[model samples]
Target: MDKHAQKIAADLLHLRGQVLSKGDPVALPLVSSSMFHLPGDPEGAAAYGRVDNPTWDALEHSLSVLEDAPCVAFPSGMAAISAALFATLKAGQTLLIPSDGYYVTRLLSDRFLSQFGVRVVQRPILGFADGGFDGIDVAFIESPSNPGLDLCDIHAIATAVRKAGGTTIVDNTTMTPFGQRPLDLGVDMVVASDTKAPGGHSDLLMGHVATRNTALRDAVLDWRKMSGAIPAPHAAWLLHRGLETLDVRFDRMCQSAAIIAPALADHPAITAIRYPGLATDPAHALAKRQMSRFGFLIGLTLDTKDRAEAFITGCRYLRPATSFGGLHSSAERRARWGDDVAGGFVRLSVGCEPVDQLLADLMTSLDRLMSK
Candidate 1:
């Protein structure tokens, strides 16, 4: 809450107005040219599409200011993470990943990075809560983790990892730069999928890595250049537009989830609830200490996969969608995606909908399930 402490709205407003010079469009101008004409020097910031773009630079600048670090944007969150891992680790190194975190990351580690000679170990997020980084070369954390919304002590783990001469990477997709700054918490690299709440709308796909270390930033940049995984100019611009209303969008969505998660938890059909925002939640205390907001996503488990499906299908207002953090509330059965959670597990992405209507939809849906 330093720079972002004050309303990030102002900075976003500045980005919209300043992306183009005086008498320019109020919105960030799209630089669509595949190649920019360089002077006789043959050296410039952006010579080709794979290299750079004005839209990307402006968006990165806005994101970096939030983290107070250097930032690199990529085509997707996975791309940014992939680049970060490839740029930092070499063959035959050890990597510690969260078993409760993003499954795709685990897939990349076990199915891809491992093939290249890296040792991949899947551990409970807090397996090293005490700074136990023995023989670990790299560690990744996703605070208020996905699907389950589990929280991890980032600062403690990062400190331990650094002491052990290992690198620390944090996926801040849930909390975002507004909700939390992982780099300030001692993490070496902060990665995010702007496709989620940051995009606000359900339309764009993008990601980025923010870091305080110049070497780490350059390495990630180099990997992105060589791999040719870059965000679309329009998508980047759309994301930046989404950023303008980020403070408002995130706050509204989180407010609704805060109300909705608790009521859903108390239902007889629900086996468990996992929203860090709730005081009754196990991660509430730690989240209060570490995160600016509890987050907009909620996790719940029904007695069976059938019941879970019934609940979602019965809802009047909530849409059944795979993604989270959109303008409309939606949910997906996590197990459908092959997550390790219970077959009845549901990941609800609360949106900027009227809270009363949302709560009623979920409650009524659950009531129908119980009756059946």
Candidate 2:
């Protein structure tokens, strides 16, 4: 087995309560109390739940190992994003974000960050590596950007931003830390919506920011504590449970996507398809160089919104939903969410379903739509 896989297994298995205990619990014990009892000295012990929790510590430690840095957890992906932004940017500083990445990030910058006197700049993901970062204080990258599935050269972009004396952050939501580690690729910080793939199930919401910089990590932790954006102990426990099976689950999802994307590309109903796993995809070369796995997201376009809806409706396995990185296959038409894409474009999040079944379901849906 690979060393990383072995490390992950050991970390997760050891999360079971007290390795030195004579009889350790089969699972990590949930400490739900909001306050820890102070006998004499409260100096070293947890004082408040909002500021700290054992469950959160376990999850953060596991994530820190994977992310190769110290990490801070938050209630949701947006909270993490907001924390990273607030911790990094100051008034009159310039922030650069991917134009085609997750919409809410842009919304946050425009509606709120701009009011604080921060200059916001938008750039497409395709050629971002070569883009000029003059006067940019921070560059927010989203390679294999959400909805579009576009790729950017992380090392190149980070190198440029660093040369210009700016911080670089990558949203690694689509490709979990297992798939890609931006820090290893020269990025200063890595933020992700653990609510997506890391959570594995659609039931919980969480996010985290990981960085080698101790100061930044401390700032993020302070923001979470002061803003009360900390995740629930239960949610953190659930995420830790999800992380235990993430290796197997993520492998199956990627393998299924490898099979399904090609099959979808060949279908007459698909006008265009974008998946870094595909050799024909424009981003394949960079993805191969940077990512260990090609991930499970596929961007495909049908003829129109009606056809896309019909295709989704005809599929038995694909659930029409907004979120991705769940156990169940889900898809959504991006244009409906005001994305700058064709009305027919669909962002498909492949799941752990058997490849043959998933392929058959997708092809059957396309065939029926064509016949109609």
Candidate 3:
């Protein structure tokens, strides 16, 4: 097997290596590079709170295995992405981005980085055969993109962009490292909101960037050191705890999402549904080829915006909120989030709840919306 495939196998087998003590799992790794007294430890290394932390390093290592790429962790998803972007580009450089990328990422490119004379163009990223991605230094992509759940042809885009001497960075937040390994598909960098599935509880917010290129990896590490975007030790520890059960949690969540996505697709009140796993989705073929799992988020658009709001509000159990990959199934109108997502669109985050309960709740909520 190739090195990437070996890494994938090793990562999938990581849970088997957990040191079991008296039948209870240990919370921390057995080996740590902490402590200043070690003979080989670097001198004058007490470089403030942001440079390095043992807890964060462990999480980064664990996540690197999962992602099959060397990684760096940050306080939030945007921090990780921002550091990566800064490392890759400079003043007057241009990056081509999916028009439907995560809102905060678009904000960073348009609202913040624009001040530095860096330009971001939102190209049509849903399909392949490259019409919109011409002449860009970098391509920022999101498969099952935020709110829209639109899957781009990662390998296609990666191949075309690489031929043109452009780099590719994919936001792998929605699919998690377990479900989708972007690096294996030839992307230059993979960024995940460790705050989501990596943290799993919605209580902590963090981000990680995984990459194979040593120079880019070192650049991101240096950017993090300079920008002070490092994550808290405790938060890193919490994310590590979540990583152990990632395979288990995501398996259940994806199963539930598969059940609900089709039901929502066939519903009379729903006009559009975007789930790459669904056979009818435009990106289904690309998604099936690139991703191991279809993931848990589904974007469904109702006939009207009012109906979308009604369904979210009327759900007896589904919470109306931002953020996803938590333990409780939640639904929110994507357009309300200040993104360019269509107004009638609803984004559903499937949780670890029973598939039947989520489906029943969804059906009831749709009925309620139809009544309105």
The TM-score between candidate 1 and the true structure equals 0.96
Q: Using lDDT, give the best candidate's number.
A: 2
Please report the TM-score between candidate 2 and the true structure.
0.97
lDDT of 1 by residue, 156-252 (tens): 8899889989999999998887788788789999889999988989899999999889999999988989889999999999988888788888878
The C-alpha RMSD of each candidate to the native structure, in angstroms, is 1.7, 1.4, 3.6
Cα lDDT tens digits, model 3, 111-133, are: 87888988878765565335745
| Ranked by lDDT, top first | 2, 1, 3
Residue runs of model 2 more than 4 Å from their true location after superposition = 15-20
lDDT of 2 by residue, 35-142 (tens): 888798889989988886999998888787667789988889999999999999999999999889999999999999999999999988986755598899999999
The better candidate by TM-score, 1 or 3, is 1
Q: After superposition, which runs of candidate 3 have C-alpha atoms over 4 Å from their true positions?
A: 1-25, 29-41, 44-48, 127-129, 132-134
User: What overall lDDT goes with each candidate model?
Assistant: 0.86, 0.90, 0.81
Highest-scoring model, TM-score = 2
TM-score each candidate. Answer: 0.96, 0.97, 0.89
Error of 1 at 205 (Å): 0.9
- Error (Å) of candidate 1 at residue 201 is 0.9
Pairs with steric clashes in candidate 1: none
